[model samples]
Target: MADATPYEDSTTPSPTVLSQDITLNWKTKATVRLYRPAVIPPKKKLPLIIYLHGGDFVLYSASTVIYHNFCNDIAAAFPAIVISVEYRLAPENRLPAAYFDGLNAVLWAQNQSLGIGGQDPWLEYADFTKTYLLGSSAGANIAYHVALQLLDYDLRPVKIKGLLMNQAFFGGLTRTQSEKNLIEDAYVPLYVNDVLWSLALPTYMNRDHEYCNPISGGSYMGRVKGLPKVYIKGDYGDPLVDRSILLAQYLQSCKVPVYYRFNQGGYHGIELQNTSAAQQLYNDMTWFVNDVYQNLNSQDLSHHHASY
Candidate 1:
């Protein structure tokens, strides 16, 4: 089930500075990019964020324009270690391929912290207790699934700050009115979604499977209880907007704290551009992080559940 070296065409080169880049020879050779703050040893262990870039699970790459920009922006904003995973795309490598790559990258990131100076950087500079998981579009799907996997493996971080799923993609066979509306929309037509599913799936598979669409599989509702808080955002006009809403509802029903935001303008990829949409998203994410930190540290760990 694991073919870490699936991406034979894409290779990540070594970092020129303190940061390094390498492929985890697992499911596919995932192009893992590590960004270290342009600073020497600091007094504190920095938080680490593992960001998964989205490209419809088939179209984009870690080097893509938007994904690249987003990585830089987050690294600058948080001034922490940021690791971006370039998982295998669909059609060439299907469904669970990306999921496994995501998990492996996280595991790698967890280990990398220890070697920042001589050991793996994932464990070195990273305060694993403050680890954060984030992604956009299809990458969000990977993040969500991996978050669940992290919980399952009992590898939960001491402090899973939050999950930032921007324009998340979560759905299945049953489409919503918003999804139906976008069936013919120029941005993301139904045919394109069908192709995405085909590429994302291994050989021939069900799109509603837990690995493909967690919401449809009823897996999301069951495991959202103790999961870390989630921040979801999307545009009202987007096809998968309903999926975000439905997922947020499920999370809320499970008593999970969810920060949901939806706007009326912008297309699926518009948020990647440095426009009003992107600024709004960036602002919300910053606020969400601050809120989580304040809320988490405000109370003693012994009485954490009481505050929630």
Candidate 2:
């Protein structure tokens, strides 16, 4: 599996968005690519989007062209400040390693938002209080884990207002209906999914472990409380579809604000898969972001309910 993205040079502005990369951790050389509208309104701060690209968990980096193009679209469409992170991958780092990198990335954003560390010029246009996290496929799985883990931190001024998961990659020892039904899926086959888990999960852990299957954990509820509003997108034709629905149901059951859409005839990361699918994905994302922003700006979202 691989997770990554980057298209234009740091110095180049693609018609709408301008992007640049910054190293987050010097020792590990972990980096994050930042994107914002080519032209910004003076004194208008935009929402911050921390995104993770997917490749199951074993492949890719922020330089992956497909993911990079997607980020460009997101930054321009939302007219937001987007940060695509580069993390330690599996087969070498494994499970919690990526999760930890995710936490570090969030914290780094917190510091930037608070001006604890020196701030970047682009971040000056970011409304740190309206932060969001987005991830696709295995990156979504990482996003989910990161959101939960963040509940344990104190990132004031860096509120996570929403989470967006696109065809989140999750599995278990027991086959879900969608997993069995889509075993021979064209986009991501069952065999390849199994191999990804084998290489990405902890050496001694099986598919039933908490990282692979969140519902399998008895105390997951305690860990998942107070998560930001969640927007989950599942592709009916993808092998991970069941897990996507299952996650939404679980989070809703926990009373976490949830909004989900399960579209027919699509595969994992469909947004990055093709032009049409990408348009729909962004449209869905736009709707969700707009709703969340409107609610946050005008009223309290603490009472937000599940909307499928």
Candidate 3:
């Protein structure tokens, strides 16, 4: 059975933002909740952020309380169009299942951009040229893979500016220092992570499966050469911090422009723990999105929005 979005009321506009749900696939219940700033700046097409929520790929929905609040905050703060994807979870639907749903969500956005599907008014303000995939933990993993999935697609009018990952939950067969040190972690125990892997990964695969550990660098790793500029962020207290470090190292070696912000201390998903951290994250995200226009892209964002 597919999990339903548990949020009872999403239509009412908050002071900062407004949100509503869209059912992308009726059968599988694949859905996306679209969020936009309440008072959209007229005549200004904002950047598009296709967000995947974090729950070890086995828990949470796009409408889950924490993820919803996170999206609302960022949509208002970054003042961008934030589309949160709700895909089926695992122990029932595993690995590639969530990944494919991520791709589908992106395709839906593509259709909206090309005006091929039923269009929504908020999406009309999306500056596809300034698009981004933003996710945290397991969602970050999905964002990275989905970005790879779109590599072959022609990106003339809609280019993904960059990826924004926060404490990506990557794993490996051999333990890193942080993983070993944090095995007895209070917030995220290693035992719990193992259980999640068992549920989310394919029956035949283990922790080292490419989906869990991209650091192994196989065919999928080679494809990452075409990845957009990346913004990877993590805190020192998380066990997976080492894997985040390893991923940043590998991408840098591949000559992909990788921006990293590793703070001194934070548990798994610190942003969810309090306001200060989330604000700092929003701070980093706004800077990154702005930097994408100022540095990674050739045309000025205002000019791009006007001309396109």
Candidate 4:
């Protein structure tokens, strides 16, 4: 995974961070930070953004080196409540475990109103009509899979708005340009892709199955047709970049409304590098969020749900 963003010269304000804590399994406790402007929020409730950090689904968490910082920056930049899930790692908890945790986290946030504090009205509070699911790398894969599950369960939250995938993970049967050309790229090589699937497949029980390859999964594709608008971001240099592009193509082919942006420079997850590229991507994300949230008011969402 191309987890680091290239360094660039720019002057941007630092992020203001707050805390969100949750205990899922009895032995595992996780804490994620919420970032926002120091100024008092204009509304009691704002849009919610739940993020799943990517470390090839094995190496990282909310406590990892970059996860906390990324969450803080996103919250500070966007006028939204951001919840980062610190899921269990693979080779230990394995595939379905992470997906299960992510799904529960979303449901929990929808009901909890206030995050960990339960008293800090601004922390976990959100307008259900504008909740978003976002993640990078393997986290992106989880986001897509979990969204499919949400659709199947008829548990689509009234407030759930859309999905944002930064350098998403989606592998098709055919080869993509990034996969063909960047087989040995430093960040994400073809071999790494195979390894991730190996780790994630145990959860699905079939590496080639729909739960693993959502595009081919009949149930997932059916759910995708009913999903909210999607936004995907990627770069040309990264191996999985083409995967994101192809997924966008598939979604568009299926007539799903999708917002796609392909950056020119940098490799995978460059937007998380804490650089100018990262800031630009952040701005784009917030703009997309504001636009979608503003338009996805209760009535609009209700209509969509009715159609579903």
What clash count goes with each model? 27, 8, 0, 5
Model 3 gets an lDDT of 0.82
State the weakest 10-residue window (summed lDDT) of model 3: 299-308
- Tell me the tens digit of each residue's lDDT in model 2 across 1-308: 01224345656545688778887766787888889888998999898999988999999987699988889999988768998888889898998999988888899888887776688878899998888899998889999889988888899989998999988988889998888887898888999989999999999899999899988885556877688788887777787888877777777777777776677777776777588878777877777776743222222233423221
The parts of candidate 4 lying over 4 Å away from their true place are 1-15, 24-37, 114-120, 153-158, 172-174, 203-207, 292-308
Q: By lDDT, who's the top model here?
A: 3
For candidate 2, give the lDDT of residue 20: 80
lDDT of 4: 0.68
Task: For candidate 2, give the lDDT of residue 189.
Answer: 92
Point out where model 3 deviates above 4 Å: 1-14, 292-308
Alpha-carbon deviation at 295 in model 2, angstroms: 16
lDDT string for model 1 (102-138, tens) is 8888776555444422445334566777778888988
What does candidate 4's lDDT look like per residue over 1-308, in tens digits? 00111222134343254544545444455334444344545656677888898887777777565776777678778866777887778878777788888887776665555333243354435666688899888888888877777775534354567888888776755666668888898888888877877786665465556645666666566657777778877777777776666677667667677876676658876766749888877877887888743322121111111000
lDDT of 3 by residue, 1-308 (tens): 11223243445534567778887767776789988887876799999999999999998898788998899889988889999998779989988898899888888888878877567777889998999999899999999989998997875577898998899988888888888888999877999988899999989898888999897755697788889888888878888888887788778777788776777788899999878888888887898898843322221112211000
Whole-model alpha-carbon lDDT for candidate 1:
0.69
Better model by lDDT: candidate 1 vs candidate 3: 3
Q: On TM-score, who's better, 3 or 4?
A: 3
